[model samples]
Target chain A: MRALCWNGVNDLRVETVADPAILNPKDVILKVRLSTTCGSDLHLIDGLIPTMREGDVLGHEFMGEIVDVGREVTKVKRGDRVVVPSFIACGQCWYCQHDLYSLCDTSHPKPELQEPLLGYPTAGIYAYSHAFGGYAGSHAEYVRVPFADTDCFVVPDGLADEDALFISDAAPTGFMGADFCNIQRGDLVAVWGCGGVGLMAQQGAMILGAERVIAIDQYPERLAKAEAFGAIPLDFTKVDVIDALKELTGGRGPDACIDAVGMEAAGTGLQHAYDRVKQALYMETDRGTALRQAMLAVRKGGTLSILGVYGLMDKFPLGLLMNKGVTVRTAQQHGQAYVPRLLEHALRGELTPAALATHRFSLEDSPTGYHMFKHKEDGCVRAVFAP
Target chain B: MNPVQSDNAIKAAARASVTIGRPADELRTLWLDPGTQSRIWTHFAEVNPLDGRTAEWLARGPAGGEYRWRSEAVEVGPDEIRWSSLDGADVPNTGQLIFRPAPGDRGTELHLEVRFDPPGGVIGEAVSKLFHIVPGEIVRHALYKFRALALTGEIPTTDPQPAARKGGADR
Candidate 1:
């Protein structure tokens, strides 16, 4: 089977790997029909995510057909169309019962399990690197989804893979971020970062009844995407982000602010992680500028939800955060909880997450897909592989 | 594809807790027994009514065996619950479940602590860091599971032991 993988930092390759199979009673094996590179994958290729290892299959966002299922998988059987949830959860775990499946006890597959579990190699995902979860990703010809009955949502017969793929990760992640930010009808929401997740966050806010959605990013293509999604786009490189957000909010900060930029925001890549290690750590001014800016942009007592993965960062301004009394909610999207609802919306044509997918590649050309997405070459916001 | 493990080795790994300042081999002798082991699995496997379809899956044991039945009662103090696993699999990772009862109007508090013990040498250090957990986070999972089960009184899903089938070995 042919699959796209990252051999190491900055080294992505398309290689032949063994085909996946149903090794557990609760597993479902999907023949990869459509899969895409997440913005986090760019972090992996740029050497931003230090824990990514060699031969890491680099995809997590996908929607495919269930070509096979384990004896225990009754919810989804062979020939069923489903959007596999990215979070690998044992259906029985406590967190999973609460719909916090990403934090499931089984996310960490024990090294001792003699039989292969379902899902990719990492914690329980299709194609994220080892740092997140070593699940074999969906970039291959076939990918296994663990806890298939609980996590994978069967796509409606009419839904296209292109339309449903982002339901696996981006759409729900975006929605979860919005939910954390407490989006309300007629609320003024500001979203920083116009990447795939950011765009979905904007849409999520709109779906939740926010009257005005202001999206901030430097890239014109991304900003344009925000505009297409009915959001007000602010080019941070051209104008002051705070001033623009304030202007939109009538001198008050936005009712809710989302930092989709995460730790990937240029200089302060390590601040969130480092700040946790030490108290009152001093940071270079530009490193956590976006985070600080987010604090200023969110109204007093309003919420700031961070949906990005922090690789590591220099310093954090705890003082300012404390003084504002602003609530902060951050999470790696509990994809299991979001996929089913998001897929319903996609099937209804109420949301279109794959609108951000601007480039396509064959499994053999996945490295080029990664390169283009990383460099934002050819205006690529998201790229997919047709295996 | 499955191979059998020696009884002694399985016993050693079950009781291991690096944070408790004990060697892996000594964990079994100190904190675990069949009764306590079943309690943890039953607690983890119980269901919640608010959880719809998945709740049914939780109540039903896996073909290997679901977390089917168990009874736990605090014997010595509010925190110490003597438990037994009837049909489901036992908690294999660690066996020490500490419970602290409520002093006033607050309900009884239970703490199920599983301290991870890494393999020997530098490799252990790396594993420990990768699987970092605050004491609160550990207690939170245990108490939350217990609460869910106590309130719902049934396992949530039909298949409590969902296995990672294909890619479990790739890592």
Candidate 2:
């Protein structure tokens, strides 16, 4: 099987690796149809997330057909078209039962490696670093899906393959971000970033009854995409985003702010330069410009929902949140709890993730795909790989 | 009169605890189950239940070595189990695992204490450390794995298997 392997920082290769098999009683093997690059994968490629080994398969957001099933897998069987959530979950765990699937206690196989760094272990993820679980990713012809009965969701008949792929990660993460806001009637929501996740979050806020959704980014193509999704686009490079948002919100700021850009946030000026130097020196793990801006741009009693992946930030503004009595909610997406609803939304044409697939490539060309996505070349939001 | 203690006394001991989101009785049953015990302690060669309150086990030591021991339950109850190795064991060891209802109905608070004396006392301890087999880490990892297994139904592992271990080889 040809799969994308992460060799080192900024180094990816199309390597022939052993085919995946059912490793557990509840596992299933999926013949991958579509696997796409995510912004979070950039964190892995940039050597920011730790514990990546040589020849480790790299990819997460994907959809496929089940080619094999474990003895204990009952819900879905061979030939079933499905999309699995990126976070590998054991459905019987307390966290999973409570709708916090990403925090499932049993999924991380190497908890010892993460205990010291994270204070406690988190659920394992596919093709993420070993710090999460070292599960092989879905960038190959075939990939293993553990706890198949719970993890794999059968894609509905009407949905196209491209539409179902982003639901595995981007759509669910965006939906989870909006869900965290607890949006009331006519509330205004501002989402930072215009990538797949950001655009999905902007759409999700409107779908969840937010009267106005403001999308922030500098990319003209992404901003245009957000505008097409019925969101007001703000170019941070041109205008003072915070000031512009304040004026738009009548000085109260958006009711809720979402930071979709994770660790590698881009910005101008001395603060971003400081963060870049410190991040290069290993003193911090995130470029928190987007998060800092979101913190200042939110209303006094607003909710700041962070869907971004962050390790450590140098200068976090906890004091502002505390003084303003703001509520902060953040997590890796609990996709299992939201995937069914997202499927319904996709079926109804209320959420369209298919538009985010700006480029397509063969499995062998995944490195080129990632390179284009990394540099945001040719206005690529996500590069889809068909194996 | 006080007895004189040896200068090279080897008491490699460790204590670790985790609050699992399950009842004390449930956690006790899972811990005592032979199959669950073997899965949680993957390094062990075997864990066979002899009687209702005793188990014989073979633990994998450094350099493909094996250590045999038999343990009998000294104290048993709904919330606690204490066991100690019999005199015929290769190395002397004793351990106690306690389960108590956590405050505010969170879950069971499981506490484990293990003490063992290696074959060559301090030298054995040094050799074990050099092999990346610290007793404290072993006990801590075991306790954590137990918590995960008890709460999540499977022990998570990133240890590459036969299929994924073939580096860059096309099938």
Candidate 3:
């Protein structure tokens, strides 16, 4: 099978790799129907996630059909369409019980309690990471998912792969981000970053009954999409965002803010990628300028939610926050928690997260798909790979 | 030997700690009122109930998120106010409120230290490191709520109400 392999630091290539087979008695092998790039996957290609090795297959968000299932796998079987959870988790763990399956104790080898990663230790889903269990990703013809009973969700018969694909990551991430933010009806919410996940967050807020949803970004195309979603769009390049937002909110800033930009943000200019990568790998910290902006913009006595991947070591401001009377909430999207709910919404046409699927490519052209996605080419919010 | 200078020193120390390392922020400074404490812990129909739903809602975006904290007035001498996440993760997150009183100064400096076990493994560490970027902001925001409680003896509710400190003051 051909997988999208990380060739290392700013390099990615689609190459022929070994086809995955059913592993554990509980594992299932899927013949991938659709897979897509996550903003976080750019971290691997940019080498910001230096922990990944060359030839590491890189994709986490995907949906496909089970071609084979292990003896114990019951929730899904051959020919069943399913959404694969980004992480493989042991159903029995302190973290799993509370829907923190991403933190499942049996997911990783050696059980390093301090670092946050996803999936099984030796095997996660296709090409995401090695440290979090380097399982080959779904940007290939075939991929394996462990703990199949709990991790794979059967896609209802009528849903297309394109529509259900995001159930694997982005859709759930957006829903989870919104759920974590706790936005209520008639609330004024602001979302930073208008990429795929950002757009979904905007839609999520709308579904959650936010009266005023404002999306901020530098890209005109993204801002346009945000506007279409009935959100007030703020282009950081054109105006003083804080002043504009205060004006819009009648002197109080937004009630809540979500930083979807994470550390890959571009403001004055894209930080030297090499420098960013070095800090991410060596310093064990992140340069969180976007997060800082989200903090500053949120209203006093408001909330700031972070869903962007901060996969680096960096200083976090505390005193400035102390003066603001703010609350910050965040988490890695527990894909399992929101998939069913969001899927139901999608089925009802009340939400269409699949609208972000602006581009598509076959498994063979995945590198091009990745390039288009990383550079934001052709108004691309996300790219999907069809096998 | 001016009292103001000593008070300024502790404030400066707290400010400096917010930037450089985790230890300084972990130290405690001020006290929180019981009503504000209840607002964060018990969901009293305030602006932020400080509950798990608040955290989830906040993640969706500002308009969507809400949060509440479970707090207690602890007897620990070094730390006066203690709080924990009502919705616990793998590693329980606890906050310590420390007060630093400078000689001859009546005002105290506040510090909040938040600690949690990282999720996943080495990958989880890398991911957690990224997540650390925003937690500081969240903690700082909580401090502001604490300050409002301390000054007004009231937890800011979504609906306007009287300030406990002013005994019927309205804003």
Candidate 4:
């Protein structure tokens, strides 16, 4: 079977590899139909995330048809079209029972590898590096999904495959971000970065009753997408983002600020250069431009919803967060908790995430797709691969 | 995979544990069940019952070294089991398991401790920065697998899979 693999830093290739089989009693083999690139995947390709092994498959957000099922799987069987969450979860774990699927205990096969850095391991995710659970990714012709009932959500009738794909990750992640904000009536939400996650977050906030959503980004296409999504777009390159956010919110700051631009934030100042230099030298593990701005642009008592993935960064202004009485909530998305609703939303035409699929490629050309997605070439928000 | 044993053996102590959502009595029953060994400890050492309170153990390292020993149960209770290696065994070892009720109704807190005279020291046994607790770290991971089997009815693994190794496969 042909699959895209990560060979080295900034290196990717589509290769023929062994097809996947059901490895556990609750596992299922999915014949991948659509696998999309994610912003978080860039961390691995750039070598910022060092846990990736050569030949490791490199995709996460995907939807597919179940071709096989292990003995213990009884919920959805072969021929079921489902969207699988990136994170693998055993629904019986205490965390899963509590709807914190990402914190599921029994899913990560190699806990020893991550226990040191994180003190505890989260759920294993498909095609993510070893630190996340080195499961084969969905970029392949077929991928194995463990605890199928817990991780795979059936795509409702009338939801197109392209529309259902982002429900696997981007939509739920953005929904979880808004859910974390605890948004109330008339709340103003400011989201940094107009990439897939950022755009979804704006829509999520609006759905959850936020009166207005402001999206920040430097990319014109993404900003235009945000505008189309009914969010007020703020281009960071043309205006002082912090002041612009303040001015837009009547000098009170946004009621909730979302940093969707994770570790690889595009910034415009000396601080951005400093973070890049420090990160290159391994003195720090993340660039904090977007996060820093979000911290400053949030109201005194607002919620800081961090949907972005982060490792470690220097100069975190904990003092400012504490002094302002801000509540911070962040996690790998608990997609299991939101997928059902997201599917309904997609069916209702409330969520149309397929627009994020600006480019498409065959599984054999996934390397080139990733290249465009990484460089954001041709205004590609996400590069979708059909196997 | 465990490393090959060295002639210059070293004394090592490994301690690991997990908390299962089941009660201590249930866990005790599972621990004492004859099938539990094969169920959770697959691909590691095998324990075979010898007498009523003794078990013969055999372990084969990945690098082709075999180890044999027998352990005699010294102490047993509803919540605890303790054992020690019989004299003159290839590996001198002591193992203890304690099952106590966890706070806030989370379930049983299972504590496992194993001290052994290993044939190889830290460097050869495990190439990890956590070498000081390398064997213990391995034990901790095994304990999680045990937890997985008990909680989810399966042990998670990603082994014998295909990948494009450097200079080996076409892109």
Query: Model 2: per-residue lDDT, tens digit, B1-171?
Result: 222224333335667877877888888888888777667666433668786678787877667676788988899888788889899887677888988788875788888887777666544365354334666566677877887777656566544431233564312
Judge candidate 2 at residue A58 and give its lDDT: 91
Please report how far candidate 3 places residue A331 from its true position, in Å. Answer: 1.2
Q: Give fnat, all candidates.
A: 0.00, 0.39, 0.00, 0.63
lDDT of 3 by residue, A79-101 (tens): 98989778666554445666886
In candidate 1, stretches whose alpha carbon ends up further than 4 angstroms from where it belongs are A48-50, A110-123, A265-287, B1-171
Q: What is the interface root-mean-square deviation of candidate 3?
A: 27.2
What is the C-alpha lDDT profile of model 1 across A1-387, one tens digit per residue? 777767765877777666666655677788888998887666556554444556666678887888888777767788987787677776564566667777664454321221122221223454444435456788877887777887778888788888788888888888898888777666898988888888899988888889899998888988988998899999888998888888888888898889887654221133332443234233224426667789877888888888876645535676667888889898677887777778777777778887987999998988888888878998898998899
Docking class of 3: incorrect
Interface RMSD, candidates in the order listed = 10.7, 3.2, 27.2, 2.5
- TM, every model: 0.69, 0.90, 0.65, 0.90
**Once model 3 is optimally superposed onto the true structure by TM-score, how far is the C-alpha of residue B166 displaced, in angstroms?**
74
Using lDDT as the yardstick, the better of models 1 and 4 is 4
**Per-residue accuracy of model 4 over A1-387 as CA lDDT, tens digit each:** 888888898888888887776678898999999999998787677665556788998889999999999999999999999999898889987888899999999999878777876778889998778777888788888888889988889998898999999998999999899889999988999999888899889889988999999999999999999999999999888999888888889999999999898764211112433455464754233337788889989999999999887765556989989999999999889999999998988898888889899999999988889889989999999999999
Candidate 2's residue-wise lDDT over A47-92, tens digit each?
A: 6555777678899999999999988788998999999999998887
Each model's total of backbone clashes? 49, 2, 75, 0
Lowest lDDT sum, 10 consecutive residues, model 2 chain A, at A265-274
Instruction: Give the number of the best model, judged by DockQ.
Output: 4
The two-chain DockQ for each candidate, comma-separated, is 0.05, 0.41, 0.01, 0.47
- Taking chain B only, the TM-score of every model is 0.32, 0.78, 0.41, 0.71
